[model samples]
Target: MKHYLPQVRFWKIISIILALTGVLFTLIGIFCTEGALAVHWGSDGTPNGFAGKIVLVLIALMGVLSMFSGESFRKERPGWHIPVGPEMGYALSTGLTGCCAGVNVIVVLYYFRPDERIPAVGAIAIIVLYLMFIMIAFYRDRRYNGRDVKTGEESHR
Candidate 1:
C-alpha cells in the first residue's frame, strides 16, 4: 500500500490539474456570452440551438466530480472482481481524464464565439487520447500489483 501511495497521488494531481483547467475555461466562457451560449449543433456543422452558460458550469462540475472519483478508486479493495476490480484502475483514471480532456477541448472551441462546434478531427483525437490513457492506467495497475505485499513474492493474484 505504501509503495502505491506515490503513484495514486500522482493520478490525483493530474485529475486536479485537469479539473481546474476546465473550471477556468468555463468561467471565461460565461463572461464572454451575451445572452445564452450555443449549446447544440446541427448535422451540417452549424450551431442550431442555444442554452444558458450553465452548460459550461455542468462541464466544470463533471471535472470536479472526476477528480474525486479518481482519488476514491486509487485504493485497494478486496471485494472487487478482475475486469472491473480495484486492480483495474483504468476506468477511473482514464475515464475521468478523457472526460475532462473532451470538456476542455469543447470549451476551447466555443469559448470565443460560443457557436462553433469542434472539428471532427478534434473529436477523433480526443478518443485516441482516451484509449492511450486507458493503456497507461492498465500498465500502472499491473506494475503496482507485481509484488504481493503479504507474501513478499512475485504476485499473480
Candidate 2:
C-alpha cells in the first residue's frame, strides 16, 4: 500500500491541476461580459474575443466537473460509482466536446466559402473539443484502479 501512495498522490495532483485550469477558464468567462471582450491580441483574427473567452471558460468548467466525477468513481466504495451527478457530468461533457469537434472540423474545411453562419458556426466546436479532452482525462482516471487505505480492499478508483 505504501508503494501506491505516491502514485495515488500523483493522480491527485493531476486532478488538482485540471480543476484549477477549469476554474480559471470558467472565471474568465464570468468576468468576460465586462470589457474583456473588446481586447485584441496580435493578428490572430480569432473569434470574437469575448465569446471565445466565454467558450474557453465553459470548456474549463466542463473539465473541472468531469474530473470531479471521475475522482468520485475512484473514491472509497461507499460513494464510488457516482450513479448520477458525476457520471452524468462526465458523459455530457465528453459528448459536448465530441459534437463541437465535429462541427469545427466541418467549419475549418469550408472556411474559404462565404456563408452567413460560416464565421461563428464552428466556435462552439472549439469549446466542445476542449471539454472533450478534459472529459477523456476523467475517463482515464475512472478507468484506473487504486487501493483504499482504510479497508485494505481491492477497490477501484
Candidate 3:
C-alpha cells in the first residue's frame, strides 16, 4: 500500500485539476453564451438538438462529484473493496471528469464559432485515451498488489 501511495496521489491531483477545469469551462459556457446551446450534433455535422444553459449547471455538478469520488481513492478503508483497485478507480473518475471538461470546451467553442466543423473524431480519441488510462492503471495495480492475475490469490513474494 505504501509503495502505491505516490501513484495514488498523482492520480488524485490530476482528478482535481480536471474537475476544476470542467467547472471553469461550464462557467464560461453558461455566462458567455447568449442563447440555448447545442447539446447534440447530427451526423451531418450540424447541431440538430438544443439545450438550455441550465445543462451547464449539471455538467458542473458532475465535475464536483467526480472530484469527490477521486478523492475517495486517497486511502484504503477496512472491509471496503474496489474490484479493480483504487488506482483504477482514480483513473476512471479522473478520465470521466476530463471528458466532461473536454465536452464543455467543445460546446463553448461551438457557441462562439458555429461555422467551424468540429470533428467527432476528437470525442473518439478522448474515449480511447480514457480506456488506455484504465488499462495502464489495472496493469500497474496488478504488478504491485502481489496478487495473481488469474487466481486472485495473494502471492507470497
Candidate 4:
C-alpha cells in the first residue's frame, strides 16, 4: 500500500502537467491567431465561419476541469464502486485528465496551423493515444487487485 502511494502521486503529477500543457497551448493559439479561428470546414475545404477562438476557450476549460477532477479524487471519497480502490481511482482520474487535456492540446495544434486546417491523421492519433491511456489504467487496476488478493490484504483498507 505504501508503494502504491508513489504510483498515485505520479498520476496526480501527470494530471497537473497535462492541464498546464492544455492551458498553455490554448493561450498560444489565442495570442498568435487573429479573429474567427476556423472551427469547421466545408466539404469543399472552405472555412464555414463556424470556428472561433471560443473552441480553444472551451477546450482549455475542460483541461482545467480535468486537473481539478483528478485532484478531487485524491481528497474526496470514491463516489462510485466500479473503480473499487485507490489504485483504480488514481488510474481513472489520471487517465481522464490526460485524455481531456490531450484533446485541447491537439485542437490547439490543429487550430494554430497557418492554413487553419487539422490533418485527419493528427486528430485520429489523439483518439488512439487516449485509448492507450485507458488500457494502461485498466492494466494497473488489475495488477493492484491481484497483488492485494495474493497478499491476503483488504483492498479497501
lDDT of 3 by residue, 20-135 (tens): 77788788887778889987888888899889887877887776676556545655678766555677777877787777777776777788878436537557757886988788
Q: Which ten residues in a row have the lowest lDDT in candidate 1?
A: 1-10
- Each model's TM-score? 0.67, 0.30, 0.72, 0.63
TM-score attained by model 3: 0.72
Question: What lDDT tens digits, residue by residue, belong to model 2 across residues 1-157?
Answer: 2221113444445455545644553454455333333222223444333334455455555554444343334355664554433433344434443443333233333333434344444455556655665565555445543534445456753
- Model 3 has an lDDT value of 0.73
Report clash pairs, candidate 3.
none
Tell me the tens digit of each residue's lDDT in model 1 across 63-90: 6766555435645568843354443463
Candidate with better lDDT, 3 vs 4? 3
* Candidate 2 wrongly placed segments (more than 4 Å): 1-7, 32-45, 48-57, 69-157
Q: Using lDDT as the measure, which candidate wins?
A: 3
Error of 4 at 92 (Å): 3.7
Model 2 TM-score relative to the real fold? 0.30
TM-score, ranked from best to worst: 3, 1, 4, 2
**How well does candidate 3 score on lDDT at residue 96?**
75
Tens-place lDDT per residue, model 4, 99-142, is 66666565566555534345354456667766765666666666
Best by TM-score: 3
